[model samples]
Target: MWSRIRRAGRVTALVLPCSLLALAASQSAQAALGSAPLTPPSDASVSSRVVQPASGTTQSVMRSESSAASSTSSTSASYTVRETTFGNGTVVREYLTTSGAVFGISWHGPQMPDLNDLLGSYFPQYVAGVKAVRAARGNARGPVSVDDSGLVVRSGGHMGAFSGVAWLPSELPAGVSGSDIQ
Candidate 1:
């Protein structure tokens, strides 16, 4: 019996690394964070990437109006947002700049949106920051915030209610403010 347990431990040790490596490889194959288009090409892709058990329930588009800080002139292209709702009534909103960069993303629903897919390449940095915060706070509960140089992410909620917002500070349009993310 002891020998069987030892063999099982060895197998697990070998399998764990391989599984982690495969997961990392698969994630790296996904599109990059700042470069990829904010929304997926179709609802199918959104369901697979953003939320699980998503029904592709609702999709809506609206123009956001933003005035330049230096002048009253406004541009419609800079403030466009696409909102997609999952089966569980969770909504994921993607905010884009005039140049087509996805500067901000927000989500609210019963379950948390997959950060790996949402943040893309920046997810690693965000994860590292979260670990640091958790260690420092000794696993305190509340909203989680990461204010890295270029990235700002805040997410918190209890069961049946989760919401999060993430944005690239430097990527925001000149007239846009972080508070504008919503």
Candidate 2:
């Protein structure tokens, strides 16, 4: 009777492992079917320049431009530094740029959870969509133009909001156009 009990225990342990493995496999399969793949990072560098407001100036931000275009003719590259209000009511100074062809996006905002977390989640998708647009359009001889048409949300809070920027030399694919959103 004791040997019979021992044999039963060994069999149960083996079965438990196999059951767990099957469960894990099913969960992974469900994830693959239920969601899209995560976006990858863009291949552009970001730089920051700071300016101080005059002692009694009510102006919130100062603007400066330095024309340094990337070597790629297919890419439109530009940088802007602005003071903007974030979703959590925190005001932040940020610098962002995009390499036209590659659609590289990077920003620095307040250290708060709302600002940082929103950018972290939304940026990847934004870059991915931009890259897709670029790839579909093919090559252009000049920088792509982006127009700030106001903010639209993609996920959480106002942080996911994005302005519609036009890409110039609209080399949109055979069936695509600049008005279409990816």
Candidate 3:
């Protein structure tokens, strides 16, 4: 009985440290999710600017303009797309409408870009909507969408290749539709 008690105590000691480590890691990740700085959206010209720092490249975010294609124009409006590549091979593209509002944003890669940064002030609403939908559907598969009169957000991705888009519906240019965002 004494040998069994010692064996159990050793197992408990190992498990306690592992559990504490996992808890700390999760807390840090949650904090990091909302720690990215916010960038003001632009309306007129097409210019590529670093809106979100690519993962693992936080120090040189403003200087990492080489990953993006320059802004382009069309008959109705202009857009700037900034592509930031992460260490894990994810590429995030933020699309701004001519009015300077972020009409659309997309991500494709091994990990999803932080929505708290991409969604800006609207992240809370998106989170609430998602919670409601999940509660209602109880395990809904496929894409998640939050549609409001002023804002719209859609996100869906699996494992290593996740992707999502969010847009300000009212800020979309005259000739631009949500489908035109991607």
Candidate 4:
């Protein structure tokens, strides 16, 4: 009887840690829109990462201009984009303001990243927006668009290829616009 008890205790010891780790992993590990993170989490293997620092006080976010981004301007109202390409071929980009607040997120690839993880606190808003769309149109058959409560999410794609973007209008940094999220 003592041996059985000891065996059960050992099993519990092994299972408890594994279960805790799984729970932690299952939790939302992303810090997005309206918030900042110490180091954003990524479940999938990262193939590459690129950090685009803020340029000077430009009229707009000129992502196409590498030289502009390379320049330093303390007065720049521009932003930074930390792009991560995962092993699955999906690329997720987080747009952060000078204060480190994540104002926007965009993703594109053969498979869609988990939006719940990406949106974090804003997932409920996205769900409500989807419900509203369904109620108005009878069906949100294709493309997901949520334009309410200062949150604008535009996402749509077919099988094997998907892309989407979400941003907080109020959180957008100076001189940034919808076009900058991409």
Highest TM-score, which number?
A: 4
Worst 10 contiguous positions by lDDT, candidate 1: 44-53
Question: What is candidate 3's lDDT per residue for 1-182, written digit by digit as tens?
Answer: 01222464463332335665554333211111112222322211212542221231211123222222222222233454444555445566566543334567766777666677677677888988888778789867677988877667788978887887777777665555677555
Question: How displaced is residue 164 in candidate 3, in Å?
Answer: 0.8
Candidate 2 residue spans exceeding 4 A from truth: 1-92, 95-118, 139-182
lDDT of 1 by residue, 1-182 (tens): 01222464463332335665554334322323465443332221232122111332322323222221111122433454545565445677666554445678888987676788889989999999898888899977688999999889999999989998889988876666778676
The true-versus-predicted C-alpha distance at residue 83 of model 1, in Å, is 1.0
* Candidate that would win on lDDT: 4
Task: Score each candidate by Cα lDDT.
Answer: 0.61, 0.28, 0.53, 0.66
List TM-scores for all candidates, in order.
Answer: 0.63, 0.19, 0.58, 0.65
User: In angstroms, what RMSD does candidate 4 have relative to the true structure?
Assistant: 9.9
Cα-lDDT of candidate 2 = 0.28
After superposing candidate 4 on the true structure, give the runs of residues whose Cα lies further than 4 Å from its correct spot: 1-29, 37-77
Query: Number of clashes in every candidate structure?
Result: 0, 4, 4, 2
lDDT of candidate 3?
0.53
Please identify which of the two predictions, 1 or 2, would achieve the higher TM-score against the true structure.
Answer: 1
| lDDT by residue for model 4 (30-81), tens | 6566676313345443221223334433333333223333422324435666
lDDT of 1: 0.61
Location of the lowest summed lDDT over 10 successive residues in candidate 2: 29-38
